[model samples]
Target: MPLEFAPANADALPLHVIEQAGLDGWTESQPKSVVTWVRANNFTGSIGQVLLIPGADGAPVAALVGYGKPETRARKRFVLAAAAEKLPEGAWHVASGLPRDVAETEALGWLMTGYAFDRYKSQTPAKAGLVAPEGVDRTRVETLAAAEALIRDLVNTPAQDMGPDALQAAAEALAAEFGASCTAVVGDDLLTHNFPMIHAVGRAAVRAPRLIELRWGEAGPKLTLVGKGVCFDTGGLDIKPASGMLLMKKDMGGAANVLGLARMIMALGLRVQLRVLIPAVENAVAGNAFRPGDILTSRKGLTVEINNTDAEGRLVLADALALADEEAPDMVISMATLTGAARVAVGPDLAPFYTDDEGAAQALAEAAAGAADPVWRMPFHAPYEDLIEPGIADLDNAPGGGMAGSITAALFLRRFVAARYMHFDIFSWQQANAPGRSKGGFGQGPRALLAALPRILNL
Candidate 1:
């Protein structure tokens, strides 16, 4: 079932969040039996500690969750969710002890804890529901979770079911729901439409490649989003080892996240003309697959030497970014699970983005902290621009020597983008399950961008 809020006025019991130092005083207000129960259970209010107090009737009358010390809380996100997961299946509300500034965030964390991707098996989540805390918008918080579920569902699907055609169908479905326009340029038509790089990277796969486009909201500042949609990367002619191919199904995580962001924007009726471009493909190995030495011309007329076929995500994105720049929208952003170097640099938890606009960067940084969606800004670094410039062609798909690889990949995509652009190198997969997050397809940057759009676009 979807994550939802319990009715504002339901038969919900009080849930108290306590700190270690204040535990004694908190218990003083409770009945003697409840205090005895809490003390006997050694409930010191460490972070995520769970303790339920029973009434004279021997039924749970209230619950307690430890908020822990300031330092413990500071080191983690979704602190409330840690304890929320341990609660029994029922409606819950934070009655007291949570700080005001964190009320909304904690409420959201509660909802996130309810997510479970059970599309294939019987992995149903506990039917735990949270009442929206005071001053938090339940509708907005729930909508965001639904949109996030869309990304998780799409990314969690195997490449066999989520090929280019399926991805395009997903986009069309979203466009239909919003009364927007959705279209695609597929297969040989990609060549006809001048998306040669996208075609070249995906032509080897049995499933045709496509540039999926969805447009919405005609009356506001134009913002275009480009996402890399490589459905399954076998690394083409330069195939990856078997171990590297295990998670290849998540290569389209960027497109999944973009569609998720699009859902957020359209659902809220945000005042902005939103255009989404996703270059959908599968970097599968085949007899006629584009080779390592092959040179492909992009829609922008820049030639890229394929030094490594594993670098195909950037190729497809280059064409899409060039197309996005043609309109010179107020802003253009590209999201891609583009490089392993990104994970090596900041690990899988952080979304690393690059942009030249200080205002937009600052706005995003501020919004990320508030949203609990962290993003780190990487520099364009003009001094290293030469790293992408291979002598054989205007650019090299993968520069030799892996030093600063994420930066080089960013610079390569930067060549095709001339608008006020930002690129997010997202992992888009949860490395491990913790708190509100699960161990499967996950989102990294959409929330931060969603929160920052208003300030960045003056919407």
Candidate 2:
């Protein structure tokens, strides 16, 4: 996209951003022909309003995007980006009018607008592009955009090509790029190595199940990330209806998102000894698939009664979280597309997280807002602990009566480890297309997590 931008020269179109209050003064400085054009169009600089000033030859000489009202800008993060998509086909540079504090975020938003998933179908790339905005970190913005592309690409791929083996390859590729170490416990080796629940839940699929681990960095506080890698959930023996299967390809979104953060961390050289654990699997149904009423033992030695096979995501995540907690890392954070209850709680836009650490929670909330990545802190409410405990086994995979589903799921994962743990119940699919974010596998929480890490870990 940077390459697509018209070279920063006299030939490039200058893009001026205007607010309603400055409209008259801005017009006063323009040529009479341009002023008349602006007045005739009644361009008041409201959001999403675009206009082009033409020269005597009639080709566009300049372009402008409205910044809208102060209150309108306050309610949205990437308001200018939405208007960016509507600009005329040509290269442009931000000439003036972006506040210095927002310059970087808006520039990053422009880079985000460059994404297009062209794997299965050829896409006509956007002709319009922007050079790096003034006073912005070019390296940081590109790194973030590239990492985000990784998450979207991995999640966008179909389960046929993105199963456990492929997921392991992706992680190993990332590790190789950073000169880190990566290893996976695959198929029957999982049971031989004590990841019983992970093996059991994924055993029915023809594609083998595996536990992938990547290690990097040597000098700093330990940061461990555990992600649920359910590539495609057919809901095992409990079986979801056809409607429930449409976006199942994004079930592995959590793993993709964690890897996105890892990419940002390594690329930015954050001071942390990072360990990423992914339990990659396919929750498919076969005669031998793990079923309801089956009691399985987790890596942490907790027994879990499966009341619903559809709850297999937390089962795999449980084993991975247990493994992550073993070394007592400074922090353990797990991300997963875990439950529909989470979607009901906050809809599809906000990532809902659970943690008992107040200081860390506060830091993350503040950081998320600044990063333009919204995340809400849900409690690790102790009162809901009993809801996950089944009389028969030590825990219930799916508690009946389904109240506080997200909280109960978080509590169930909490039972596996004792650490400064935070869990994000994410809905990683973007249901509608918007500027900078197309309607497919989208990342949540990771950008916010990236922003908050320095403060949360005291780097």
TM values, all candidates = 0.98, 0.96
Candidate 2: misplaced stretches above 4 Å? 1-11
Off by over 4 Å in 1: none
Positional deviation of 334 in candidate 1, in angstroms? 0.5
Q: Which digits, one per residue and each the tens of the lDDT, describe model 1 over residues 1-459?
A: 567799988888889989888898897877787787887898999998999877778888889999999998888888999988888888888888999787767777778787887767778565667888888888788878888889988898999899999999999999999999999999999999999999999999999999999999988999999989999999988899999999999999999999999999999899999999999999988887999888999999998998999999999999999999999999999999999999999998899999999999999999998878899999899988888889989999999987899999999999998889999999999878888788889888999999999989998
Candidate 1 Cα RMSD (Å) = 1.1
Residue 370 of model 1 has an lDDT of 80
lDDT, model 1, position 113: 80
Q: For each candidate in the order shown, give its overall lDDT on alpha carbons.
A: 0.90, 0.88
